[model samples]
Target: MKERFLRAGAAVLTAAALGAGLSACAPLVIGGGAMVGTLMAIDRRTAGTQVEDEGIELRAASRIRETLGDRAHINVTSYNRQVLLTGEVATAEDGQKAEQIVRGVENVLSVVNDLGIMPPSSLTQRSNDTFITGKVRASLVDAKDLTASAFKVVTERNVVYLMGRVTQREAKRSAEIARGVNGVRKVVRAFEVISEEELQRQLAQPAPVTQDPAAASAPARR
Candidate 1:
């Protein structure tokens, strides 16, 4: 069991390394697909569901901007069709409004509104949050028994929010890893918990193959 998670994490280390180094950059991809295709391939969500999550984030963000404008500082992160709203709003009313907008988005199963009532966080503070996020991500990658790709880490005001489809063991283990990171004030989990049996079944499924660019460019056999 430990060996399986280690192997999976090792498979994506190169891509993850680049992502960690450029933690502040726009998301990096591997194998011409979103978010390091290898990671996505190993993700608990089906490829189609993963795509839907991205759509949910985009649509919800757009709607929030149209409705709230600069009145709030909101970050929308969707995993497994569930939306997590973090950051601050000018007022409690704005926070409630933001949640409603997200819930209205197509295919959003639920919303976890953690929006604070305050002015937008400063650039320096936001930068620190980004740094904290990267540190938490690195901590997860270093955990041998956990498949780092299976989790999504988000930070706001030094609080780390973790989202994923995982077994209870994974949920507990990952939260421990996140809390251990420096500058992480709190760890909030929004995991879709599954049984150990379901996890084993998922692990037994074949992982997607990543083709070598050189081989991909070569002509097919007759």
Candidate 2:
């Protein structure tokens, strides 16, 4: 296990370095790679804490997928002990089963099952989602304006969910990129920002704003 972790760590570091190189125009892919690398590193550093959490999350997701038996397409994301399940299932029972599986995971503090009861994933939707995720990742990788590692992207039914700790500007840029991705229906932000003091400090920096020429002329005329 220790040897395996060492290998994983090396791979993650390599990915992170590669991701940094691609961060300018492929922020999404870089962000995704960074997220994965961070998770792997955490698991390596605190093998007991994170490995257990990951095991539980993956086990639960696999069980739910198996139980659904080809009727559903589920994506599971685990963060800090929280599990988010998204995608579609064929029936309400299948959704419930998914919830149960995630809840049964030992270290899961909470489970947000955003599983919709719908038909299996269409080829078109799958293809579009793949493309969107790839592009968004690429954008994150290439974005110079924000820390690409501070956001997480999840796509379902063409809508993109952005989550993590980021400044308002970072969040806005992330949303903009997601919106610009072809076939994206919507962009949702679920971010936690820094304290008010930090936000104020950032806001104090110079920024360009449009001035109203008519108002200036009116004041001069008066």
Candidate 3:
């Protein structure tokens, strides 16, 4: 799963770098498609975290929520189908309930429950989030060297969440474009990459590193 995510991330970054050099008018459509593709690829790779089990947890959670009513607030994030269930639930039982529900889903390798006991987001906040999401989407569509679809753009309090398969250069270009978008307070990137081989021995290996979410979330450009 990790290997797949790494590869997808590398591909996205490569695309982004390539997009960056493209002329503005030419990038309007292709960039957006590329971005979406990159994001989808990353999502697909992460779904393998359970070693082939994929999106099982997400499906389970959705079904559980539907059965239990909409009161249970849960956010499901899956990478290669390894599910991370975050957000708040009403009670300890609810948390366990979610885990059980997710576990029952086919292909779910594991579930990481980061849910807290809290209320759901207010309507106004949800509206704002939606607006931000739209803006980011539009910006990506309009920008050159950016694929609107290659990125998973999530907005929290005006801060953008960028997750996708991308190369280092593409990531940088994506960030710059996001920073230029209006109403974006910041951009957070949970991007992975493939590094150059080391010359230490006859056989070299890829260097591993955790992506810093904050690095991509810097304040919007002026």
Candidate 4:
């Protein structure tokens, strides 16, 4: 069990490191070295689902802009089709409108609104939040027993929001990892938890023959 987790963790780091360094410049191929596109084979979501999430985010953002204009400063993050709405709006009504618009998007499983009903965050605050998010992500990558790619970290106002499809152990472990990172005031889990056995079944499944370049490039596009 330990060996399996370690192998998975190593794969996560390798893909992430190579992707950051070379994805802009080259592609990684496997199994007889055939050109198979970018190193986009590490995510838990399906290719179609990823594309759908992208569409959902874009449409929701557009709708918010059309409806509220500059009255709201919003961040839309979708994982496994679940939309997480953060940032601030000028009024409670605007916040509600933001969620309503996103919920209307196709393929959105649910909407988690953490939108503040106050003034928008300043650019300095947003920059600090981005830095905190990077710290948490790096801590997850340093964790030896968890698949960091299985988790998505988002931060707002010093709070860390975790999103993903994960097993119970992974959920608990990941939250702890995020908490240990400095400047993360609180950890909020928006994960879809699964059983350990289900995770093992997924790990044992064979890779699909066809690689969707669109799916492969999802992270890059983000």
Candidate 5:
């Protein structure tokens, strides 16, 4: 029964994500740190880097919010410790301050400041940003040589920010794919570029699988 249930759940997710170019991990039903563990199994970054990136995001966000208060609207996305800041701010000084604040975060390696000098974005624009991000991510999934799970896609004001550790070929291909998405105004590569050889080495090593206890002891679903 457990095997059948898991198989059915996987099938439903596969169907739902088809044509959307999302990671198979996106719709996973696993819980807690287990969810992070499962996704990390297929992620390109080392587990340490993933943990650091998460830390950088949280630290940067907290600092940004505390320092800027309600005067500015900022979005921070950290991948492999490289942060990307987007959205709107009241002044150029505020934008610079936001980036500086993120830079002070311990694990942050670098930052890309794309915040505009304007009032905060409306709900409609933010919603559209979400839609565009999904579309770009889906497009990356459709790309033949690109691995959707290997990259992080963030969209703000129609600009698509791509982050990950990828080879030059993969990064360029990913940018091209993102640019082709309907609502993407531009594609910005914030990747930690690697060699093709390194990419292949990681690809050849299969992800470690942790058996679901209930399913493992059960009969096969087929």
Candidate 6:
């Protein structure tokens, strides 16, 4: 009973955190402290690559905004230097343009442009998507067989996009969990599939240590 209560509390807190970020339309920082530290420890990408992914997302989003302006409502998510482009574009040409701009960004290993050619989603729709994303993440957290932090969850409209460097088993399991979340219209994967051996090696490595206590306490960007 106590365990269930704790899980419920975690879900609520996580949901609230995620909702705040989504409503603000900002890049998400999943959580702080031990939870995030654990996630960072198990993440497949090197520390440098994780930082690079953040840079790629910021630069790509900026360029897209400058070039496409209000014509696109694009969400940029990068994992292991690969980018996933979601949200709506005014036209098919605008979608292509957005992809081109991201590809031109430095150190972008690849791009998956999943931009829909449609009008921007309503605020209500975005809020609902945020709720779905939060629920999916909380569900993953509650699953004993998975590490929730390994997956990056982003929802647009009613679709949930999952990005990670995961083995096929982890990818399949994560997708199933996300699909079962309420209000999720679709589940999309932009995963970098790694072998089980590689995953085992990652798990075997010690968590990174930092001299800066603040940095050490913060969640490592995936």
lDDT of 3 by residue, 1-222 (tens): 544444454455445433532321121122233333334343424323433433454466568778656657665555444456655577888888888888778766666665667776554554565466656655665665654445555555566666655667657877887788777887866654433231122123332223334544668789
How displaced is residue 66 in candidate 4, in Å?
1.0
lDDT tens string, model 4, 196-221?
88888887876444555556566764
lDDT of 2: 0.63
Question: How big is the positional error of residue 67 in model 1, measured in Å on the Cα after superposition?
Answer: 0.5
lDDT by residue for model 6 over 142-187, one digit each (tens)?
8888776678888888889999988899999999999998888899
For model 3, the local distance difference test gives 0.55
Pairs that collide in candidate 4 are: none
Runs in model 6 deviating more than 4 A are: 1-39, 211-222
- lDDT value for model 5: 0.74
Q: Please state the error at residue 120 of candidate 3 in Å.
A: 0.7
Please write out the lDDT profile of model 5 over residues 33-60, one tens digit for every residue: 3444556676788767776877787778
Clashes of each: 0, 24, 31, 0, 0, 0
What local lDDT score does residue 194 receive in model 3, on the 0 to 100 scale?
A: 32
Estimate the TM-score of every prediction: 0.81, 0.61, 0.48, 0.78, 0.78, 0.83
Off by over 4 Å in 3: 1-58, 63-71, 77-79, 82-87, 90-105, 108-117, 179-186, 192-222
Which candidate do you rate higher for lDDT, 1 or 5?
Answer: 1
Q: Given candidate 2, what's the lDDT at residue 84?
A: 75
| Worst 10 contiguous positions by lDDT, candidate 3 | 21-30
lDDT on C-alpha atoms for all candidate structures: 0.81, 0.63, 0.55, 0.74, 0.74, 0.81
Please identify which of the two predictions, 3 or 6, would achieve the higher lDDT against the true structure: 6
Q: What is the Å distance of residue 119 in model 1 from its true position?
A: 0.5
Mark the regions of model 5 whose C-alpha exceeds 4 Å error after superposition: 1-34, 206-222
lDDT of 2 by residue, 1-222 (tens): 534443454455445534532442122122333344444443212335445656766688678757776777777766556677878888899888888888887778777778888876665665556556666766665666754545556777788877665667778888998898778898877665666577656456643332333444555543
TM-score of 5: 0.78
